[model samples]
Target: MTPLSRTCRRLQDSLNSFSNTFIFIFTTSHVRTSLTPTSSTPNSLLNAALITTYPPLKLQNRKPFEAQIDDSLEQPKPIEETAFDALKPTRLPSNVPLYSMGSSSSPSHTIPVVSTFANPFETSNSIDASSSIRKPISLWPGMYHSPVTNALWEARSSTFERLLDPPLDAPPQSELLTKTPLQSRTSVLYNFSTDYILREQYRDPWNEFRIGKLLEDLDALAGTISVKHCTDDDNMTRPVLLVTASVDKMVLKKPIRVDIDLKIVGAVIWVGRSSIEIQIEVTQSTEESSDTSDEIALTANFTFVARDYKTGKSAPVNRISPETDKEKLLWEEADERNKHRKRKRECKREVENGKVDDRLEALLAEGRVFCDMPTLANRDSILSRDTRLENSLICQPQQRNIHGRIFGGWLMNRAFELAFSTAYAFAGAVPYFLEVDHVDFLRPVDVGGFLRLKSSVLYTELENPQKPLINIEVVAHIMRPELRSSEVSNTFYFTFTIRPEAMKDGLKIRNVVPATEEEALHILERMDA
Candidate 1:
């Protein structure tokens, strides 16, 4: 070979060696420190370690060796170059708080001042350095923001504050409007697999993604969608107050992995004169290819009631005009759900008024038989009271929503965890979440109030022996000691099932019998529903 060609060949080989070394150093440092397995390491972390090690090797081969050599000769670049130059950590001023956008002179260092939710009307020059108000940072489209951020933003907004407490004489209908569903559609992306800091914020001790955290995000997104649907202008003086009325259902279609990027998409599906229904879906793409279709991980429906901020009465919201067939179908489904909710409410009233159908009567009679004649009851069955588990704590400000009330999603998360524990204790196996049968936000919980959560494995279905279903109920009560009062704040029903693998140990769940007429009524009601 010619001297020039030989020289080029040597350079190419050296470059290849350098690239490989670089990849090794980068992967080893990050994976060793961040992805190291602990005693409590989850399966997902193991998979993440494997993924982190191999992907960069393929990156080195993106361009041909000859091409790289030609580029190197033209540029005469240094040998110790790195791909992470853009990622060099910024060293902020010593006075500036990390992860905070607060005033440097502010006395308080506890609460972070996130700029994403800062008051839109306030400029940096106009901000009072001595003020303790937490401002929001600018957020780009598709970026993920926590529920706290949303709350802070709302707290800082003059428009939202007006909505929260408007002038008593303010008109209920400042404007009437209609909007297409697409106009309010939003998608928030969580790049957990790629973003280290983001992953750390959401990663649980088990190295898995925290579903509770995601629930908070979902609620935040739903609230955003509701507000988007209600407002036509960015600078509205009298925006309507929207509060979560209920979470109709939340179904887990697939397990969410921490190593995968997640996208949460939501939009207003249907709107009544004073209510809105939103659909939120969580999806994840496979690591193998971004072009591959995303797998849906979860789906949920959130209902919000719009009220006049001044009068504290139901207020009309902008109607949604379905533009696409899918949108129309979603609207229809939401309508059906609305009808179902009404029917269920009427049924509940009937049961309360001592009116019952034949099927319900039969189920109630069967429940009485088990309660009245314990000796004649099946030996494999256990009283529902036996499957009960409970926990209580004071609701703190950290769990409050934009309205200053405890967030519905936080309540759901707490109830879900307790329900899972209840089922696990009853089944003696790790239970997989099936779905949230229903969630009722009967009363708003106050921060600093005594909150009690009671969970019970209401019943078990063994029709599918391989995957026995456990129906669990959780009741959240707000208690006041001074008045000796206890009122139900929320009701959550969740369904879980044992995996076939878990059932291989010859484990069988016993049927649960109602011990009282009240318990019997609950069982019959659920069965009828």
Candidate 2:
């Protein structure tokens, strides 16, 4: 139908047959000019200026106007603006301007003025997202295009699957301070080869039997082993030694097939070797290379022990904590009293912005924190008491100044011996370790630092789970995600007091009892705030 709609239905059927033969010759020239009073019709003002210069047309093609443009090109609906078309001219384009064409002009009238100021099958010069003559489709009808369509009114029905923005309900991230210090503190190490040689004994893949090939890492994976080098034959001696040093291959792009074949059993030997002798232990995980088959009820044997170079015989070694002097005088008084501190402190209020701890200097300079944590259990009990103090004893290296790097109070006293073994199996017997108060340094824990202290006792009072109020949280972390120097965050409070049947008969006590009325209204609202 569109050849300007079949030339507007052949100019509305030739203007309805020339308006019925010009209204029967103007009703016989108005009955012969009213019977001759003034017989004038010659060119009546050039036929009334050619019938007021053509505008009105189309008097009949209802229904089949190509079925209303085939249902407007099949479902292109949503252009509804009925307040009677919002009183027209809101930049007109839902295919507008089809006014009521019903009168004059006819050489098969086709007037399609769809110009992007002048388009013609678009593309190369792009302009046609419904180009109503390059915008400004209408304004002067009675003037009020809603303040110019309210600036193209974007009520945002947004798309492309909501394009990922709705995640900011804000408030769960903060604490990443820096009056200027998140860059430049480099120290990284993972060195390995120094002619690496461990020998309890397993030695057959000398490059898979010296150049025989099955070695692109146990290739299509199949394991059959037998190795040598422990001539006192602890029955073929192979405790374990996987020394793959073929080098340079970690640049993969596709088709990686690693069907697994590592069953190492431990033998990184050598009791002595110095002059910069390496000691790398990055067993990325066989559960740190040993408990892969996980069967741990209690397995705490962390002994490094390595001192016999000349036999003044020492042993214990799990080092990791190296610099201190009160952390170089607390970074020289934090660089001379906040060395001109002005990193982020002008928030002059009015930032309802993203909420997580409410702009605490931009949520600790963006660590994004939000913590409400503190509910583990309340009455049924289980608070932490830990025992077996003897099988796990027999130490020899006690040089204790432990100063620098490893002291968040010695990793919170070895994480309070792992929460005293679950508060001594929930105080069915003995639990007493009182008073550890509100300590919140908030940040600044360093020196080759390493930390893990997670204690939980969400509720209990006098009825003893050891007089509870233990909510210890110390997560000092660092995994070299580009090393974060001296990371620290603290929030601690401990108030323990438990003595279940005092280890059965020894006489003990407990405290903190507000059993209820909502824990005495939360201990009288923490003693009135």
Candidate 1, clashing residue pairs? 115-136, 115-137, 116-136, 116-137, 117-136, 117-137, 118-136
- Alpha-carbon local distance difference test for all models: 0.71, 0.26
* lDDT by residue for model 2 (1-529), tens: 6544554565566567654443211222211111122345244433332333334444454221110122223434457655554332222222322333233311133344553333333455643323334522111110111111112111111210121122223321122112111111111111112212311111232221110111111210100010111111222211221111111111111111112121212111111111001111112122233563331111100112222222324422221121456434434543342222232122312122322232234212211111122253333322222111211211112211111122233333443444444355444443344433323334434443344344444334443432333332223333223565434344333333444445346433222233223323333322321
Worst 10 residues of 1 by lDDT: 64-73
Output the lDDT of residue 252, model 2: 12
Local accuracy of candidate 1 as per-residue lDDT tens digits, 196-285: 887888776657667767777788788878877887463434667788998876788777878778888999999998999999998987
- TM-score for each candidate, following the candidate numbering: 0.68, 0.16
TM-score of 1: 0.68
Give per-candidate clash totals. 7, 25
